[model samples]
Structures are given as structure tokens and as C-alpha cells.
Target: MKILNPFRLGLLGGLGVLVAVGIGQTVISLATILTYVGAALFLALGLDPVVTWLETKKFPRWTAILTVLAGVLGVFTGLIFAIVPVIAEQVRNAVQATPRLVTAFFDGTVRENVETALPWLGVQDLLDGFNEWAADLDVTTIGGGVFAVGIGIATGITGAIIVLILTIYFVSSLNGIKSGIYQLVPATKRAKFIDLAEQVSAAVGRYVIGQGSLALVNGVLSFIVLTLIFPAFGLPVKYSALLAFIAFMGSLIPLVGTLSGSIVITLLVLLFNGSPSVIAVGIYYLVYMQLEAYVLNPRIMNKAVKIPGALVVIAALAGGTLLGILGALIAIPVAAAILIVVQQVIIPRQADL
Candidate 1:
């Protein structure tokens, strides 16, 4: 301070700038890192049972890790190959038929129904505004937008792949990692922290496995129902599976996701066949939701994640509001993790004190 060292001043200034930049960039990087870490942790937790079994059987940790990674890769590849083409075809057909669907719906009996029901609602005015908006949306603009979205999806997929690789590595070394982390804690606190971590890991793992099973059941049930109903309505049969899959994915989003999916599917049905089909599809979804809420959810999810219905809805809404689809997908698991921490650590610690 007496000499006012220029070198020290420069170093301090550089450090300040770096800290500013980190703070500025944190919002962008925070979500990405959280997502990757959450995914990896969940994956490791899910495979913990298998790892334990392997250890019991005297399998080397590296070998068990390789086996788990291979299984995961195989499942992912199979799903991609089996599902992507069907979805791609449905998307292509849906795009091609959009104008026809719009024309038919507006020109046909549906228009009369809308006119009658929504006379005061200015339904036609809304359509007119939509048309105006569509007119302003040129092909080049739409195409450019689609291209940009495609690039973003590709980048996301690449990031997911990297995360998956990291997950495998982390899972393989989970024991070592846990030991190292515990060592950093005071000896008195280490055991409690380790126990809390295990509880959290178990909660998240069970939730993931349960959700996957539920999604599969939903998908299968939807496909069966759509396949049966589409033919009676005289819509394109080829798109049924694709539509069902979309609905299945959407159902994973908790509250609003199913509703959004139902709307999209109903529109597709209306586009191809008519309003009667749309009404039928709506009825089907309503019934499906009832069954899922009452039967499937309780039977399947109860064992894995015992979240309250109100909490699930609240978490889903908050997550969707904050981060869109990805947020919604992860909201339940995050809530489960928090619940475990509260039940196993915080509450007990408070009680002890």
C-alpha cells in the first residue's frame, strides 16, 4: 500500500473482471450444468442396485460399469431407431396436411358450430387475425426458423451424449467419489451426510424408474386406443402410432402437458377426419386421465415416489413457468430430492438439536 504496487493492482483488477464475467455468464451456464449433473446423478442412482448386485457377485467395479453403460446405450439406440422414423413421418404428414385441415375445419360444419357457440367470442375475427399472421409468415422465414431449431436440437443432443458419457464415468467411480467427498467433511458429520446422500439418491432413482414404467404403460395404452378409434373415424392410420407416442411424451410433463397433447392430437384428428373425431379424441383423453390419476399413478408411482398430488401440480407449474418442457419433466424428481432431504436430514437434525 505504501508503494502502491502496479503489478498487484493489475492482478486485483483482472480478478475483479473475471468475477464479473462469471456472474454475467452464470444464468446461461447454470441451467445446463444443473441439468447434466441431475441427469448423471439420477442415472447413477438407478444403476446402484445393479452395481450392488455385481459387487455381491465379486464382479470388478469397472466391469460392472461397462455392463451398465452398454445396457443404457443399447436401450437408447433401440428407442431412437424404433421411434424416430415414426415421429418424423407423422411430423411430415402433419405439416403437409395443415392447410387442408384449416380449410376443411373453417369451411365445413365445424365453422357453423363455432359461429353459433362463439358468436360473441369473435371466433372469426380471431381466425382472421391468425390468417393475417400466417400471411406475414413467409416460407423463407418459417424454413429459417425450422433450420435454427434443428441446429439447437442437434446441439442439445450432442450435449446429452456428453452428459451420458460423464454419467457412466461418474457412476463407475461413485464409491471412490463418495469416500473423497466424505473425507472433506468433519468426521462427526461425514456419516450423516453420507446417509442423507443415499436417501436422496434412492428417492431420485426410484422416481426415475417409476416414471419410465408409467410412461411406457401410458404410451402402450394410448397406441391401442388410437389405433382402434382412428379407423372408425376414417383418418390416416399411419399416423396413429406417432400421435400416440407424442401424447405419451406429453403426458410425462405432469398437469399441463397432457392437456397440451390432447389439444394437438384433437387438432390432428379434426384436420384429417372431422369435428366428431375431435370430440371423440377429447372424450378418450378425459377418460384416460381419470384412469391414470386413479389407477396407474397410485399403483405404480406410490412405491417409488410418494409425492402429494397438490405438490406435484405446484412443482410442475413452477418448473414449466421457469424452464418450459425440460423443467416440467424434471420437476417431480427435484421435488422428490427435496422431500428426501427434508425428511431424512433437516427435520431430524432440528429434532436432535
Candidate 2:
């Protein structure tokens, strides 16, 4: 008894380690469920403003919510039906046109079209540029790139289905969900928490609305532009329908959104529509992005969360790191919420202190 009971202490430590391991596994098991919940919560917040607006015009809350959900679900279902054929055609075209795209651009026939599209680059220079760029390209790398792209598209589709299912459930029970959350907070701070939560929610809602409007404009314009440009260069725009959705997702990230899209757009245009059309698409984005940054943003997000450009970039990167594309899409709104908390809560508390 006086020897310090080393065995008992060791046994207790081992049990503690086992408990910790059990807790970690529990968390890992819950991750997928949590992800679905998070997606639904964010989507419901995004749709809340439209629901509230409908209510103001004398609609019942349930009616407004259901109407919004129905419209979203209907449009998404229709879009999938419309895009399936287009994507199939596009992939087939891409696979078939790979060789022709390389030769046609360098053949001097499309040079005038290229010059007209981007006056900054001469015809010879454009082909020469591609040649110079391609000098370092390996056939293996191209094959891998195509494979990776296919995998990404497949994953995005699967994730979209899960999100759609979860979003409907969350939107249907959003009011009850919020009330339940309120009950979780201590009574002493419940009212204050509700007020803060409302403010943050409104900020996120506005941001989501603004971002969605921008994405719509981007996607529609992409479809129109690609459809018009592709045929002019003797290529097909049969898949232009699917291009809209691609542009929509690509436009969600703050700064890098268009850049990431440009790579895909350029590759597609170069491989199928020729480099001149790629330049046309590039020029279109160059102009559109400026208008978006200056005009559309000011009008749409005038009352939304305001953050610096650098912070937007950093938040998008961090969120993308944590949760993939969905994180990048919602990163701005999250950053905005944090900013609101800092201004409304932390700074005031610090001042009182």
C-alpha cells in the first residue's frame, strides 16, 4: 500500500487514452452528417429573404417557403435534364477535336478572327504563344488533366444531389430549427443572442442573394457568348447549355473564381473552338469582371457585409481548404458574419472594459 500503487495509476491512464480514442472516432463518424446539416443551414439562410419578402406581400409563411423550394427544385431538375445531353456532346466533341484544334490554330486561317477578337495579339504571335506554351507539355500530363477533370465533375454532381435533399428538409423546418437553437442558449443571454443571430443572418442572407444574382448573370452570359462564338469558328456550341452551370460555380469564389474558370474555358475553347475563340471568351470576362467589381457589386451588395479585398481572398482560400468548393462559395458570407460580430460585440465590450 505504501509503494505508491503504480499499477492502478497505469491502469487509469490507459483507460483515459481509450476514452479519448473513442471520442475521436465518434467525431469522425459524425462528420458526414454534420456536413449535410451545414449545407442545409447555409442554403436555408440564403433562401430566407425571398421567403420573408413573399410573406410581407400577404402570403402564409409555409406557402412562401414551399413556393421558393418548388421553384428551386423544379429549375434544378429541368437544368439537369437539359444539361445531360449537352455535356455528353461536349465531352465527345472535346475528345474528337483535340488534334484538329492544335493544327487549325497554327494554320493561319483563323488568324484574322483571332486578331479581331483580341487586337492586342497578332495571329502569328497567338499560335507562337501556344507553341511556346506547349513546348513544355507532355502527353501524359494532358491525359491526367482530362481524367482529373472528369473525376471532379462526377464528384460535384454527387455532392449536389446530397445538398439538394438536405436543403429541402432544412428549409421546411427552418423556423423550428431556429427556435430549438434559441432554447439551447441560457435564458439570461437568449434575447441578446437572438438579436445578434438575426443581424448576422440578415448579413449572410444579403450576401448570398447578391452572390447568386452575380452567378446568374455570369452563367447566362457565358451561355450566350459561347453559343454565339463557337459556331463562328466552325466549332459547335451544342454544349453551351452546360457551360452556364460551369460558369455559375466558377463565379462563386471572390477573386480566383474567374481565373479558375478561364483555365477551363481557355482549354475548351482552344481544343474545340480554337484559341481565337478562347481569346474572345477571355476578353469578355476581362470586361465583364471589371463591370461586376465596380457596378453590379455596388448595386446588389450595397447593404451586405463589407470586407476588404485581401480579406475576401484569404477567407475564400481558408474556407476552400477546410470544406472544398462549398466552403469557397460560402466563405464571403462567413467572413462577413465574423466582421459583424467584431464590430457589434467585441469592440463594444472592449470599450466598456
Candidate 3:
């Protein structure tokens, strides 16, 4: 065999490494944009089933898209209106309650109770230290913190708007996007690729729909129990809407979400509403979890890809480690897509070999 030229090999290897580094840097710089695009695409896929269903019912494609978007916007707007005033009122109440709480800690029955419960601990000294720390907080530091919070809020709002616009565009043109992507494959493999792609898409869409239904059921039931039933039974549940919102969001995640939300809500009830309310909430959630696992999940997710439980856990953990909540949310579907490819493409080819 002819000897390779060491210098030429080294030069080529170095160039390849440099090119990879450049691409990596570019990706890092564009991470936020990429995240927004990915989120929009995910949301679009989730909404696709509804649009298609509407189309099948004789709705014009554009009209169906518009209707879906309108409904989503309406729901979002209604939530904002419902939530904001409550949040603002809570903030105002908190600010007004702070001085009273401080007074109670130092001079009221709260101090006595704490002293009685923890005779060994220096509650006064602890309070003094906390006060000293608070006193040491400078105006500039507080202002900076406030400014940072404002900046974060603004950035979040901007990102939401960008994602919404991108989602609308993606939803409107998803079919075209799929057709364009199919063209990139070799003609010989294009049909198979399209078939696999459609299956993957359908799996993702069904998963989204199933998960959303579960979340919605959790949210609605939570709201009814907290906002209506509890009060009727003389158990006051403060921030019912907010608590329900938390339940809704948590249930959107796969395996662990509902349990996590229930635990959080139970803890909150225990802290704020005492033993009786906590007991009620805890019992309700425990029963709900059983129903969900036995009845809701199996029925709702029947049409979606049936990922192994262990695989789902592993996939969720890996995805969450890589990309946080969004990663966790999409991980199962991604795993399913890979499973499909292996089953349909790889195994058969391997068998032939």
C-alpha cells in the first residue's frame, strides 16, 4: 500500500475540526432562535389534528386554521384576564400583610407559639439577623434585582409572541413543509420516508392530543373541587384558579406530572388551609391518580404509540437533562419515532443481511 502523506492528512483533519467548531459556535449563538422555532413546530404539530378534523368536516383549510388559532388566542386571553387581577390582588395583599406578619413574629401570639414549640432555638436572634440582612440591602441592589425581573418578563413575553407567530405560520404551511422535505430524499427511498414520516407525525399528534385531554380533565376537575365543591362544604380554597392552572400544566408532562402536581397542591393546602382541607385535597388527588392510571391513561393514549414504561422514563430523563421541560415533553414521541425506524427499516435490513 502507498504511504499516506502525513502533512496533507493533518491539514485536512485540522480543517474538519475547525469547520465543526465553527458550526458549533454558530449553533450556540442561535440557540434561542432554534428553541423558539422548535417550540413553534411542536405546537403546530399538536394543533394539526384539530385542523385536519375540521377540514374533514368540510371546513376550508385556511378557515380551520384560523378557527383553531382564534380559539387558542381566546383561551389564552381569557386566562390572562382571569389570572392577572388575582395575581395583582394577591401581590397587594402580600405587601399589606408583610408588616402585620413581622409584628406578629416579634410581638403577637405567633412569637409565643414559636418560642413554646422551639425553646432551644433563638427565634429572636434569628429575627434580628434577618432584619440586619434586610437593612443591609442597598437601594441599588434592590433596583437591580427589580430591573432584572422586568427584563426577564419582557424577554418571556417577546419569546411567546415570536413562538405564536412561528406556530401560526408552521400550522398554515405544514403540508407544504412535509412535501418540500420529502423532495430532499432520493426518489427510490422517498415513498418509504414519507410513510415513516407520516406515521411519526401521527404518533406525535395523537400523543399531544391525549396528553392535553388528560391535563384539561385534571384542570377542570381541580377547579370544580377547589372553587366550588370545597366552598360548598365549608372548606375555603384560596387561589383555586392558580392551583388548577398548576395542575393543568403539570399534567401536560408524561408519567410524573400528575403526581407531582398533586403533591404540590396538597402541600400548599396543608400550609395555608390546615389539616382538614389538606386531608380533603390529599384524598381527592390519591383517588384521581388511581383513576388516571387505571382508566384515563389507557383509554386516552390507546391510539398513540405504546412506548415501554422503562423506555419512557429513560427518554424523559435524558431529554430533560438535555433541554429541560420542553425536552421532557417531546422525549416519548421522539423515542417512538426512533423505535418505528428501527422496527420498520433497520431490523428488516439486518435480517436480510
Candidate 4:
């Protein structure tokens, strides 16, 4: 090689670093948009299997898309009507109950029970500390915090609408999108690339459907048990609708979702309805977890994703650490896609070498 000019090499390296930094800044600026697009794409993939199934039943692609969209809208509309009012009413009740709850806590009976349970703990001291802290809070700071929360809620709602619109577009044009992407591959490798890509997409679709089914099952069971069965058995479960909604949302993540939701619901039940309800809720969740693992998961997810248990845990933890809920939600399918590529391409290439 010709001897490199030191100044030129250093200048080029600096230029490269500047270009990289510019690109990173651009990426940081576009993070919110990218997140919206990713979430939309994910939802579209999840809905694809349903659209495909409708097509198999002799529905035209457009008709299938409409059918699926209508069903989704109808479900959401129904939920808004059915669930929102109950949740709102319960929330209002909770707000109204706050004063009474505080009064009861300060009353001798509740404090005595707590002090009796933990002899070393000082209930009065804890209350005094809490009161002092509350008294010391700045009104301006509190107002600012409330304003921030309002802004966050508004942003979340707007983002949700954007994601929904993008999801509909993606689902309608998914086939076209895939065809366009396939056109980019070199002619010689295009066929194989298409096959692999289709496999990965199908796997992702299946996973989303399976996970949603599990969440639906959990939500329905939770609502039924807490709202009806518990009350029938004289084990009151306050805010059952809200609790069930939480369960449904939490179960969207793999592996850890159900356990986490169960813990939260159990604790809330204990707080609201005392030890008897907690015991019932605890036992129910323990049995439910077993059934979910052995029966529901096998039937629902057997064909969707088959990653090793250890890898599943590892992927979920790593993804959760990196990107919170969304990362955890997508990690398993990403891992599955990697596995497919390794099995199909890397292993074969290695063997040939």
C-alpha cells in the first residue's frame, strides 16, 4: 500500500466521527416518530393473521381489511361503553372514599391492628413523618407536577391516535410493502429472501395473536371471578372492572406479565377487602398460573413461538431494561426471528464452509 498521509488520515477520521454524531443526533430527534412507526407496524403484524384468515374464506383483500378494521373498532367502542363508565364510577368512589380512609387510618382500631402486627414498628411516628412531608410540599411544585401529568396524558392520547391510524394503513398495505421490500433483493437471492421474510412475518403474526388471546382469557376470567364469584362467596373485590383491565394490560407482556399483575391485584384486594379476599385472590391466581402454563399457553402459543424458557426470560429482562414495556413485548418475536435466520442461513453457510 502507498504510505498514508498522517494529516489526511486524521482529517478523514474526524470527518467520519462528525458524520456519525450528526446521524446520532438525527436519530435522537426522530425517536418519538420511530417509536410510533414501530408500534404501528407491530399492531399491523398482529392483525395480519386475521386478515389472511378472512381472505381464505373467499373475502377479497379489501373486504377482509374492512371486516377486520370494523371488528377492532367495534370491540373498542364496546369497551368504551361497557368498561369506561364502570371504571370512572369506581374511580369517583375511590376519590370520595379517600377522606374516610384517612380518617379510619388515624382512628385507633386500624393503627392498633398494624402496631399489634409489627410490635417494633411505630405507627404514630410514621404518620407524623408523612404529615410533616405533606405539610412541607410546595404548592407551586405540586401545581407544576399536575400540569406535567396533564401534558403527559394529552401526549399519550395523541400518540395513541397516531399509532392507530398508522396501524390501519400498514395492515391494509402490508402485502404491497412486503412485495416492495422483496423487489430490493438481488435477483438471484430474491426467492430465498422472500421465503425467509415471509416465515419471520408469519411467526410474528402468530405470536401477537397468541399473546392477545392469553390476555383476553385472563381479563375475562379475572372480571368474572372478581365481579361475580367473589361477591357471591362474600369475598368483596372492589373495583373489579379496573382490576381486570389492569390484568388484561399487564398480560400483554410475556413470562412476567401475569405474575406481576396478580401480585398487584392481590395487594389491592387485601387493602380494600382485608385478608379473606386476599387469601381467595392469592389461591385463585396460583391455580390460574398453573393452568395458564400447562393448558392455555400450550394450546394458544404452541404454534406461535417455541423459544427455550431460559432464553425467553433473558430476552424479556434485557428488552425491558432497554425499552420498558414495548421492548419486552417485541423481544420474544425478535429472538424467534433471529433463531429462524440462524437455523436457515447461518447454520447452512457454516456447514458449507
TM-score of every prediction relative to native: 0.78, 0.79, 0.85, 0.91
Q: Write the per-residue lDDT of candidate 3 for residues 1-353, one digit (tens) a residue.
A: 66479898889999999999999999999999998999898888889999999999999999999999998888778777887677567657656766866676566455554555446768778778988998899999999999999999999999989998899899989999999999999999999999999889888988888989999999999999999998899988766776887899899988889999999988666544555676788899999999999999988886676878788889999988898888988998899999999999999999999
Task: Output the worst ten-in-a-row residue range by lDDT, candidate 4.
Answer: 109-118
Strongest candidate by lDDT:
4
Candidate 1 accuracy as lDDT: 0.76
Candidate 3, residue 241: lDDT = 74
Lowest summed lDDT window (length 10), candidate 3 = 108-117
TM-score winner: 4
The models' CA-based lDDT, in order, is 0.76, 0.78, 0.86, 0.88
Clashing pairs in 2: none
lDDT of 3 at 258: 98
Q: How many clashes show up per model?
A: 0, 0, 0, 0
Please give the TM-score that candidate 2 achieves against the real structure.
Answer: 0.79
lDDT of 2 at 308: 73
Better-scoring candidate (TM-score), 3 or 4 = 4
* Candidate 2 lDDT by residue in tens digits, 192-297: 8899899878878888888788888888888877787656766454456656667887777666776677567665554445554566666777787788889887
- Positional deviation of 131 in candidate 3, in angstroms? 11
In order of lDDT, best first, we have 4, 3, 2, 1
Cα lDDT tens digits for candidate 4, 182-266: 9999999999999999888988999999999999999999999999999998988999998999899878988889999999988
Per-model RMSD to reference: 4.6, 4.9, 3.9, 2.6
Error of 2 at 198 (Å): 1.4
Task: Rank candidates, TM-score, best first.
Answer: 4, 3, 2, 1
Output the lDDT of residue 291, model 2.
87
Better of 2 and 3 by lDDT: 3
Q: Tens-digit lDDT track for model 1 on 202-303?
A: 766777677777677777877887788556656334478787887878776666766777778876665465545556676888888788778987897788
- Root mean square deviation (Cα) for candidate 1: 4.6
